[model samples]
Target chain A: MEINHTVIDSVPILAVSGRIDATTSRDLENALNGLIEEDNNRIIVDLAGVEYISSVGLRVMLAALKKVRPKQGDLMLASLQPFVREVFEITGFTKLFLICPDQREAISKMKTG
Target chain B: MMGINREITVPARLGEIPAISDFIYEVMSACGFDAKKIMEMQLAAEEACTNISNYAYEERNGQIHITAAAEDDLHLTLEDWGTPFDPTSRIAPVTESPAEERPIGGLGIYLIKNCVDEIHYQHRDGKNILKLVKNKD
Candidate 1:
């Protein structure tokens, strides 16, 4: 997977592409952890390029969310692929996350809420 | 459709998941599963095999053998010669609990259960066999 980081309106956005599995998730974990350590709390993960996500992949984000939430920060996932969205819905992860249909809404949430 | 038990054997490593997933797609497609159903099975397969690769073999290198058989329902049987551990023994995760309150790692088994219509697990001769069955749609 390829992860590119950019700042949008003071909110860090990670655009992740490729399939996320146990092995490839290291890059994502590193990216998220780096941002968290840097005190960039509220972040948006753009998964438009990500076509598939496994449970292990989900665990990385969940762990990061848990870590950042203590600082009153949250991780918002935006632009999920259809298959990925269905997996989240089936796993009931939609309740645990702030998922937006697009990056615009996620950035807005980071600013407004 | 009656299939003649298509199967593949690969090293039990995280990197082998893509090949396994491809094999799963082929078998499931041959058994006439839809796109969404095939993805569900693929996800479950990855989750199940991941547990085996992470915990079952430990320091020893092992191989994961998967068998796809469909006479009525599609059943993908994953067999590993690593230490016998029953992934299905774990109870379903409480999705009702707040995400902060829930554990992170247990989602694998829960997702494996949710993707399939029926699941069966057994240990025989130092092999852990997990059978994920999806009904024909």
Candidate 2:
């Protein structure tokens, strides 16, 4: 998977592309953990480019959420493709995280709070 | 419609998951499964195969044999010579729980159950065989 890191209005945005399965979730886990370790708690993950995600990928996101929530920060998701979104929905993860239609909305929400 | 059958063997290791997924993708696509169904089957196959790779063999190296056949439905059978365990025997995780309160371990099998139409497990001749089926009709 390809992960591009950027800052949108000071919120760290990770745009992930490619399939996220057991083989590639570690890369995502490390990147998210690295961001959390650096004290960047409020984060947004852009899944518009991601075509697939398995439970391993979900586990990484869950772990990241657990870490960031304690610091008064949250990991928001935006632009999920249909298949990826279904996984979250089936797993009931849609209710667990803040999901927005785009990065602009996510950034706006983050700035408002 | 004509039937198709194919099989592959990969080392029971995390690194082989992508290859296994690729194989599933190719066969499922050849079976005329739509993009959405293809992705669902891929996820289900990966979860099952990854579990075998991670827990079936323990510390010793082993092989996972995956067979795919498509007729009226798509069938995937995974066989391994490692420990005998039934993935379907576990209860599905509670999806209604809040994220923080939810545990992490059971999601794999949950995905497998949710994505596919049918699943069966058998231990024969000391080999654990897992069968997953998705109907096209």
Q: Which is the leading candidate under TM-score?
A: 2
Q: Write the per-residue lDDT of candidate 2 for residues A2-103, one digit (tens) a residue.
A: 999999778999999999988899999999999998999999999999999998898899899989999899999999999999999988889888999998
Error of 2 at A41 (Å): 0.6
Cα deviation of A26 in candidate 1 (Å)?
1.0
For model 1, how does the per-residue alpha-carbon lDDT over B58-81 read when each residue is reduced to its tens digit?
736899999998766788999999
Q: DockQ for each of the predicted structures, in order? A: 0.57, 0.72
Q: Superposing all C-alpha atoms, what RMSD in Å does each candidate have to the true structure?
A: 2.2, 1.7
Residue-wise C-alpha lDDT for candidate 2, range B17-70, written one tens digit per residue: 888888988888888888888888889888887778666777369999999999
Using DockQ as the measure, which candidate wins?
Answer: 2
DockQ of 2: 0.72
CAPRI level of candidate 2: medium
Clashing pairs in 1: none
Score chain B of candidate 2 by TM-score: 0.90
